[model samples]
Target: MIYRKDRKVLKRVDFGAAKNSLMGVLAALVVYALVIAWGRVYEAFQLETLLVGGAVVVVTAFRLWLVARFDALYGAGPARWRKLFAFGLILHALVWGLLPAWLVWRVGTGFNFFVVILYNVGVTTALGSSWMAGLKVRQFYILLMFLPVIGALFLGGGLREWLLALLVAAYTFYLFRLYRGQYELFWHAVTRERRSGGAERRRELPASTDIQLSLVYRLAHELRTPMNSVMGMMSLLEDTRLDDEQKEYLQVAGQSGKLMITLIDDVLDYSRILTGRITLSPDYFDLRGAMEQILEAFGPMAQAKGLELAAVVDRLLPKRVRGDRDRLMQVLTNLLSNAIKFSERGEVRMDVDFTAEGEHDGVLRVRVSDQGAGMDTDTLKHLFEDQFLDGAVDAFAVRHTGFGLLVCKGLIEAMGGAIGAESVEGEGSTFWFTVRLGMQADMSESSKLSGAMADIQGVVVGAGAGSLACLQEEFEALGSQCQGARDYDHALQALRAGHREQAEFDLLLVDTHGRRELALNLCRNVLEDPSLRPVKLMLMCTIEERGEPTVQRLVDKHGLVTLVRPVHRTGLRIALGRLLGVPRSQPVQDLPTETPEERRRRKLYRLLLVEDNEVNQLVTRGMLSKLGYQVKTVNNAETALALLDQENFDLVLMDCMMPDLDGFAATRDLREREQREQRPRTPVIAITANTAEGAQARCLAAGMDDFLAKPVHLQELETVLRRWLSREDDSAAEEPDSE
Candidate 1:
């Protein structure tokens, strides 16, 4: 590949071969001269021989000197390839061709043996030299070697001479081919050496890269271990009686830890994608279930922002579809997260519809649209370019490489899907993607919206066309009759026209996104009208608008239900259920009193925590204890394995990285041992800070029943416990004494 560059390398191969062959050629010429002089050969033949041999020796010596000079100026580019080739041809012709032809004509058969020997020596010496070993130079030398034989073949007087000339010509051709083959072999070796040198450098780069990535991963986990303890301790402290100042301090500490955790997560995610660690695990999962879980995770966040978050799925879509549930959730979470981060007042909505479906598969189009501060053309151009998030940086709230949208793009593409965004700078943005999923034939129809708000009449006013359409559809889906109005005036006129108590709608939904003032005035007018005053009033306002005095007065004094911006279909259902006295199918979980046996059962629920770091162990143990769990921790996997035989653990919290027998190996061993002894398999949860893409899958492959990352929150830990341990076996045990 670097052939052109190699031309600059003055090969030691050339100079060494040139010097050796010069000695051989000169010696051969000396032998020829001595033979002629000693024999007292014919005067003419002797003179001719002396002249030719003298010329040959002088030319050969000069050529050798030239080669030396060329070597010295190899890098100077003065001796072009064509010049070298011409020189080789001319010199070889004089020594090998012309000398032989002249001897054949003057001495005839008498000195033919000497002539043959001289020709052999000249051609052999030239072939042996590396100076003319270049492909082009060697070719020229071969051509010159055959010239004398060709001349003698037509001009020879005898058959023997012609045959001898033919043989010599054949021999010359054979030597040239041999040297050419050798030249090619040598070139190949050189190229191979250069390539291997480059390969070695390339290999070294990835090795160093691997080392650096490993260090970052380890450092992140190490940092998370301590932060987990601090946050967990703070959470425990918050549960205890504390003054407002102490509570605020703990809150600030918790917030800082959460932010740090987010940053760590972003780093790990980018690294995982960069290192090709992510892969899809497709399985049939409830689409509704996935959507609901995301809503649940971000509902509090949306609510905190005083925003509405909801999903609207197509009615004909399959209840369960095949896809990577976790990854899809992650993508949606990232989109929803970005929406919430940038949106201060408007709604964040997720819209899902069936794009295509067959007997065993379906394609779903998902869009996470938000009425937030959108992007300009310039920002959109580089929206997905790799960069770190910073304060006031494109509305990203974390300090990490690339925004979440980049990660979403990678995941969607990996899933054989495409993603894009549409935004108006001051209006909002909508991010959408399409994914192929397997169809669940056996799944029942979804009950998420079944009777969510029955027997209710509602009117949505002053909402954007999209928002108004979504709200009306949601209400109708919940068995309610609803109508949409473009503005507050239209809604007020409709309410007044239906003045009869029975004909009037029971609920009024107002969008305060752009017409907050008009919406407030309408709400006040509704309160004044006796016919409309009884209607349950729910005003949608931006987070910033919700803090305004007028909005607060409307909510506090007028007893109006307030739904935050970007209201979800589910969120709307919940808000409607509260306002219109509609009974929800599945109410929020309520804590019930436990009897003595229940308490005893809970006390018996045991957890074995396997962690190497003392801080992690303490933090984990404390968090578990706060949840009324009985925990036994060991510093290594060996001790954990030993304890499994001594006591039956309901669940094992395995730390993936340890001094000996890491979580993966330990889980595998535990699973094998349980199978051999025919004992009930205990659940092993990987409690690692290793957030690499395939880390959880690795744990699962190693027989882990679940995964919980480091600085495990109390809720996640409790959820893992409840999922693995039977509910009847669950109990609120007495908190263990602090160590």
Candidate 2:
């Protein structure tokens, strides 16, 4: 057991040492690499030289990865990463000590052997002095690195070796005296920063971008650690037996946690844009899914106020388009958030359409309309400007918070998109934005519907006109003839008429616009009507509506499929197919849907999954294994380093943020190692929740070949994997071994 006081002191030591050890540690690795390459210098003892040299390289690289991320892995309560970091430092010294002694014992006191002794002295004093603080740890490291060399020299016999050993011994003693002073000064500085708050001091520094970048990564690590734990525990619990109510509670907790994590990532992205680094990351994504996601996020808030929240995509628009999904979602989120915040009743709806620009390119437009207190003309003029002028809040009739509007404006303009809004006083507002997107080759609006729901009939009862039209289009898109109704009476009449022809209607979709009582009556009528028995009864309700006792009873006893508000077409299609007792045979059209034969044909290449969380591990490995890839998952950067050194991997799927280290630095160091050893470059793809373009650039700069955003979908994963794995390696031809 460890005492808290002693642990605190050790944390300080580890933190300080980590701050100043990276460059020195990297220099030590360079020395090791150089020594390994010089193995041919001892031609007679080449194999022995290579053996010890390889050990040096491995130990140095291990130190490099650990020291690079020691602070991140160090938490307040657990000393797990702390102890591991200490062990790495000690091992680094021990390896340096024993390996060189073995080299001299094997090579004898030849000319090059003396040269080896001199090299060891220079490296020991040089690198050891560079280590910042931590008196005991550094002193121990110094002794271990020097003693073996001194002992080996004394064992060399003769007056010449003795004289040189004495001189080295005198220098090591002198070096310790000097190192103590250095440690004292560095420790004081660490204490000072710790007392004042390191971040406060960092912010006061001159380099603005560096300060922001460090803060972003540090905050991300701090938040991600606990979120990972919560989600991991949820995943573990999912495998256990539980009652129906308990399972539902667990499911809700898991989904809420996922949304929270996404919100945290948005915080990071928001900070990045504030740094004035923005770009567009265009890729293939489902537009309908993106819109549905934003609407779902704000649906509950709207429903709480007895308002309707819905999104509609034009039937003429492609299901899949090539654009920057993150920015598009960000823009939509800002608009929808404002819409729901200001709206008290009525409806908030999002609409989408396309404007063709060329054969392969087009402008995608989105509009968010809300029945909120409309902005005045004066407020609309300065809507995106800072509302607080001279510390005075005068901008009244605005839509969203000024900061959010500014961020959205910057991101949209960076993507070559335009944003504007129109409003009428005392009425409502509609904000619209447009961005250029690439059309998939031979893109078409219609998907060939399969026999699962082909030629079927459905009735849609919606509280809002926008929702009514949207649901009908979605039904028709799935090859079902749909009849729309504005109210419950019309829905019942349509059902009665359609069901007269031997249950003509295959499904019924009802949207409960906060009218729990009305929805409950409709469910009872559906159960009582014998003709509607074979028809799939589905209700789209808000969170509050789902809690109504009658609605719960109708769903539990009568086998009604209750869908949460803001349901997407894809999810609805699958649910209907399952209820109808048929496989989901819907066409994806130009969407990247992998067939069974093609999925199986993918080579079972070895994949290294470097994620700090077990839930993420559960998610990623489960997906990759199904795709036939042999996966090896590691939780920390050091273990990942060790594995990469020992085994060959075709590709690496790494969470750019790790528990103890920023994956960017780790990947950067890994790239440097590959170059030093002249090894083949394996594609390293970053798995991140922040899909902002600046973050993508940072990943690439850190030596990652590509990126996959979090909550990764199967189709997207397949596309990313196939693109990288199928490419010819341009760097596979190593340079001839010239040390």
Separately for all candidates shown, the number of backbone clashes (residues 3 or more apart, or on different chains) is 11, 1
Clashes of 2: 1
Quantify all predictions' global Cα lDDT against the true fold.
Answer: 0.69, 0.69
Candidate 2 structure, TM-score to reference: 0.48
List ranges where model 2 is wrong by over 4 Å: 1-276, 296-301, 387-402, 424-426, 445-462, 475-509, 526-539, 542-564, 571-583, 586-739
Measured with C-alpha atoms, the lDDT of residue 407 in candidate 2 is: 73
Per-residue lDDT tens digits for candidate 2, residues 339-437, read 988888788888888877777778888889988899889878877665533235422222345456777887888888899999997789999998888
Model 1, residue 446: displacement in angstroms? 9.8
What TM-scores do the predictions have?
Answer: 0.56, 0.48
| Model 1 deviation from the true structure expressed as Cα RMSD, one decimal place | 31.1
